[model samples]
Structure formats: structure tokens, C-alpha cells
Target chain A: MGALSWAALSLPAKPPGLAKASLDRLGESGVAHPVTAVLLNYRGYDTLLEVGVLLLALAGAWSLGRGEQPAENPQSRPLLLSLLRVLLPMLLLAAGHLLWIGAFAPGGAFQGGALLGGALVLLILGGLARRALKRERCLRAGLALGVLVFAGIAAVTMALTGGLLQYPPGAGGALILVIETAAMVSIGLALGLLYLGGQPPEGARRSLLATPPDHA
Target chain B: MIWRSFDWFLLLAIVGLGWRSLNDRDLFRAVIQFIAFGLLAAVAWVRLRAPDVALAEAAVGSGLTGALLLSALARMRRREQQAVPPRTEASE
Candidate 1:
């Protein structure tokens, strides 16, 4: 029931002690990013709430899985597709580097992993999404297993640390890395799973949804 | 600023993909376009100093979304296949 509420602090050039501490950790002076510490440091209650919000969103997505399917459309040329095919992966990897750099600079796990996942999404949209799924039961197991393992770890942390998710100050960076990484995988899996369930057939959901009921 | 050169190109791709996604002749392409838009948006995030948000955008926005969309496509394909039953000659 820990709601992780992040403190609102101006990422201006100079600020209060908390801001300074945060920047020092990232090895930067500016504080443009939301100080997760304020949320994580002092607001254990809110972090749990944030997890609840995520859970709600996940629930909503699952609820939306009743629509028909969409028909295919023509896409851009082969050359452009080829170029993107080459470039997207590189962009994602760079994002990961940025995340690691954020430990002593700016850019952290969330940003880095997002970029990587984004690239994967791009590849999938380009008509390659199917290959990744493989229709294998093991893949499904992996998806659920990753989530379970993360949850188990977090629970263990709560037991050992006397808080829902407090890592030692020394291991702060490592903790963030672990959480964000797991988040990336789980989020990607969830998104992909939703798509599989929610898309409508040839705008069937849209058309049906767009047209209201008759005045009987 | 390595992102500079790729910025405009990705932007164009996003717009093109998004527009096509929303109003293409085929419903399926639209879903794909939406996924592309998410990826490009991630690039924009990387440039904009919000790695965390970008990660959310990419994975949640595109990855899972694309998978969901593809499944939807498969379902539609199944429906289509069902509609056109093979070998329906007059039963003598």
C-alpha cells in the first residue's frame, strides 16, 4: 500500500538541498527530470499507489480486448523501410547507453529502456511483429515468468528492507536499473498482448462504436 | 546531437505513418502506423531529455500495442477466411 509520490521540484540551474543531492547522484547540475527520490525516498505510500495505477491501466487494456480485427493497408516503399531497419536498433542501443550514463549524468533506465523497446515496436509495425511472437507456449511462459520474478524480488526487498521497495542507498542505481529493466520487458509484453486482443476487424469496432444505437 | 539528422526523417515517418494509420484504405495498415508513430515518438523523447517517458512511450505505446494489433489482424483474417467457405457447389 505504499504510494510513491514524487516531489515536484524545479529542475532549474540551482535549487534546494534535495535537488542538489539528486543532481549529484546523476552527476549533473540541472534538475529537469522528476526527482524520483522525493517519491521513492519519502513517499513509500505513493509508490504502491503508482503501482496500483499501473495495474488499473493494465486492467483497462485487458477489458478492451473484445473488438473485431482490422484489414491490412499498403505501406511506404522498400528503401525507406530498409533504412529504418538499419537505424532503429542503433537508436535503441544508444538509448540504453544514455540510461547507464544517467547514473553519473542524465538519462536513466526508463529513458534508455523505452528507446530500446520503441525500436522493437518499430520493427514489429513494419510487418515483422509476427516473427517475435512465434506462437510458442514457452514465449508466453517467459512473459509471465519475468513479471512473476520481478514481483517476487520486490516482495523480498520489502521483507528484507522493512519497506515495500527500499534498496540500500549504495545500491540505488542498481535498484533503479533492475526495476526499470523489468518494467521495460513487462510493459512491452503487455502492449503486444493487448494489441493481439483489442484490435478490431476492418474497423469493425470503430464503425460499430461510431454508430450509436437505434431510436427504437 | 547525433539525433539531429535522424530527427526530421523520423518525424516525417511518424506523421506519414500516423496519418495512414488513422485513415488508410486498409484498417490493418493504420494499426501498424500507430506502432510506428510510437517508435518515432520515443526518438523524440531521447532527444528531449526524457528517457523514462520515452521508454514508456516505446514499449507501452508500440511494442505491446503492435502485438495486440497483430493479433487483432489474425482474428480478422480468420473471420475473412470463414466468410468465404471453400467448395460450395450445388449439392446434387
Candidate 2:
């Protein structure tokens, strides 16, 4: 039955269900990336709400693991440490490239930010960077930055254009870039912290020189 | 014809990995299987001509989610060990 259904399915003759006008106006929308234009310009409100949803997820995770300190694994090998030193910077570069190319290609804030988040997780696993409890304020601020920046832009754009997030004709691209950059940073930090499972205690630095666990 | 065969193979791998992960008794093995599923899903997205979704699936779907699952697993293991202290051979 499944094979019959699969065989029956075929691509449409004329690329069904896309608004031709929207495709034509994609370039004029101030971003060459059609997906970006659609996500941040045509449907900016939805993107803003999505960022809020990410924040809500983080909030829920934090509450669930309240007052729990992340357990340290001190058994990171030197080889892994050296590898990460080389790899982390490369990942950051790739992320930056993705963020930049997102203006004209398939990359975007979410993809780039996720790469950064992955790098952060790698750093944590390698014991190079620790999530400190004392830095909760900083973490909180970073988490909120994306939504705040997005909402601020929405309000400002509303004041200027008399409609929410309606960018001025010539200024749309720059505004979207600004919003994407802020969103990328916030998303990266939020995701990385989420992987920690709980807040780290103040002054918990797992140094490279630290002794490995006996099992290692 | 070759491309169609490859697509079928990819589809089978995805299904097989998903089923294995769902049924795996070892939580760690399940997490690894799930990560593999995510990567294959990203490849499927790319084949579908949506590079944007593919990049997202590879990055957030596979990488970050895998890390989250592993950390949660670690925490769970720690809790389990604490709850069930080792019964020494002498005691047994």
C-alpha cells in the first residue's frame, strides 16, 4: 500500500501554490534571501513571536531545574581540548559566514545561531568554559535581548510608519540585518545555556590542568 | 533510476533509524540514534531543495538537541546512582 502511494505521488506540473507577485517582489523586499524576506519582512510578527517562544522554553527549563548546579565532568582528554581549540573558532567563523550570507542565501539567524550554540556546548563539554550561577543576570539579559530588540524595532517602525514592523521602503534591509544579528546572539546564548540543564555555580572553572576522574 | 534508488535507500535508513531509536532500551543509544535520524532528515530536506530548512535541521535539530539530550541523560544517571547507592560485595 505504501509503495503504491509512493509511486502514485508526482511533482506538480507548474510549481503549485506560490503567489507570483510575492516571488516577483522578493528582491524589492530588501533581502535577496527569499526565506529571510518572508520570515523577517512579510511575516515579521510571526518571527518575533517565535523568538518569544524560545525564551519561554528557556524559562520553563530554568524553573524546572531551579537551584540545581550543573555537575562537572573533569575527565576531558587533552586531545579533545586541543581539537576544540582549533574547531571552536572555525565553527564561529562558519556561523558568522552563515549569518552574513543569510542576506542573500539559504543561511539565516536561526541556522547561524544554532551553530554558535553547538560551539558553546562543545566548549562546555571540553571543560574550557563554565556556566556560572553568578552570571545569571548576564545570561538573563542575553536571553531576552533577541525579543527585546525585535519588539523595539517593531515599536519604532510602528511609530515611524504608523504600522507595526512596516519598515520604510529603503531602510528594510538594514533594519532586518540589525534584528537578525541581535536575534542570532540571543538564540545562541539561550540554546547553549539550555544544554547545561541547570545553572552553574559561581566561580566553577574546570581548568585544563585539572586532574581527570579515576575512571578516565 | 539511480537517483530514485538512492532516495529509497535514504528513506529506508531514516525509517530504520527512527524505529531503532524508539525501541532501544539503552537511553544513550537511543539518543545517538535520534541524532543520526536528525542528520538524515536534514539530508532529506536538502534533497527536497530547501537548503534553509536543511541547515536548521542539521544545526539545531541534530547538534543542539543532541547535546541537550546527552546532558539530561547524564543528569538522570547521576540521580539514579544517588538514589541507589552501590551495595558492596562485602554487604551482599
Top candidate by TM-score: 2
lDDT of 1 at A101: 59
Chain B TM-score against the true chain B, each candidate: 0.70, 0.90
- How does chain A of candidate 1 score by TM-score against the true chain A? 0.58
Per-candidate alpha-carbon RMSD to the true structure: 12.5, 6.5
Task: Report the number of backbone clashes for model 1.
Answer: 28
Residue-wise lDDT of candidate 1 within B1-92, one digit each (tens)? 66676777887887787778888887777787788888888888887876666766775567656665666677778878876665343332
lDDT of 1 by residue, A1-216 (tens): 123322233345454556556555542212234444443334434644544454456557546654432323316557647877788778667866765555444455445544555565455556555445544344345445435545665687788777666655466555655654555455444443444453222222334347544633
Candidates in order, interface RMSD in Å? 4.4, 0.6
| Candidate 2 Cα deviation (angstroms), residue A167 | 0.9
Pairs in steric clash, model 2? A133-A200
Q: How accurate is candidate 2 locally (lDDT)?
A: 0.84
- Worst 10-residue lDDT window for candidate 2 chain B reads B83-92
lDDT of 2 by residue, B16-83 (tens): 99999989999999999999999999999999999999999988999888888888888789878876
